[model samples]
Target: MTGTSPKHDVFHAIADPTRRRLLHLLVDREMPVTVISSHFPMSRTAVSKHLRILSDAGLVKERKVGRETRYRLEPEPLLELKRWLAFYDRFWDNRLSVLKHLVEADDANEPETAVKPIKPQAMDPLSLD
Candidate 1:
């Protein structure tokens, strides 16, 4: 839902869970339509449609070698997502660092105590009011 750009369209295209899975499958291995469909319970046509969406998004690329159309993942679009995520990653790291310092200081102020068995004190319900 960001501004339209080449990479923005690519991110939108791969936003779907199914499409993302397809990209992951194609990451290291180039797979055919039938091979990709077998990993999913959906029909071959449905898989093909998802592949088409990924292809349109530039998250994946397809090539026809003889009878089978092979699909491969394109990582260039993902770099954008990683870059966006990196900012948040650094932000959280700094926040956690401050928290760690506060927690260490707190632990320094408190000494560990031996556990003592507790006897339950009976409270009269009449006194609760």
Candidate 2:
């Protein structure tokens, strides 16, 4: 392993918008750096740097073909992220369901009323009435 810090997590790899788009582009099929660079306005070198981060995070796999390097999406690592998000999804769903139930129950107990206007108080500071 290189002397790089072990700060390369899947979350960190996908944190950048460019890197996320790169993953989306490679989702269907493997593509070479040149083709992938065409989808973005950045330089090929910048795209390569993003790919390197994804590679380090295990979100992508690189294969060398003749004179070019191809990259493919490695989605297994993202399953961990999906599972993490799904847990919170369930938590929020349960909480929201309970909230809905409470609101509906409260509405059922209260009767609907027409709007009422308050009459002005006849108090005069000067006449003491």
Candidate 3:
């Protein structure tokens, strides 16, 4: 019916390298906006704009301390990224295990000299079952 939408604001926000860097600066501890902006050559306004994007993504929290605003990274979305990565990791593990088992099986049944280089069969959809 409709295009898939992300559950929250986190994914697209961290997609940019600048925003990721901003998050890295805040990961260690809360830092004021000026301190964060000083790390880059961009204008203070640019840093503020990046912070707004990060705030909308939920990857960072912004709070005012008297006269200055402080930013800190919120790592829950990073955990979600790790979980998504793990599924692909398991998929690769299973495929590699199957290939290893097949190679072992071939080695057991055939003489070392008799076994030639194994070529993977390209499956043609029209000819495949």
Best by lDDT: 2
Candidate 1: tens digits of C-alpha lDDT, residues 12-124: 87678988888888879899899999999999999998888776667788899999999998888788788888889988999999999999999888879865899999888
Looking at model 1, report the run of 10 residues with the lowest lDDT sum.
1-10
Ordered from best to worst lDDT, the candidate numbers read 2, 3, 1
lDDT of candidates 1 onward, in order: 0.83, 0.93, 0.84
- Better model by TM-score, 1 or 2? 1
Off by over 4 Å in 2: 1-7, 106-129
Off by over 4 Å in 1: 1-8, 114-129
User: How well is each residue in 1-129 modelled by candidate 2, as lDDT tens digits?
Assistant: 566633488899999999999999999999999999999999999999999999988899999999999999999889979988998998899999999999999988887997589999887779955
Q: Give the TM-score of candidate 3.
A: 0.65
Model 3 regions more than 4 Å off: 1-8, 95-129
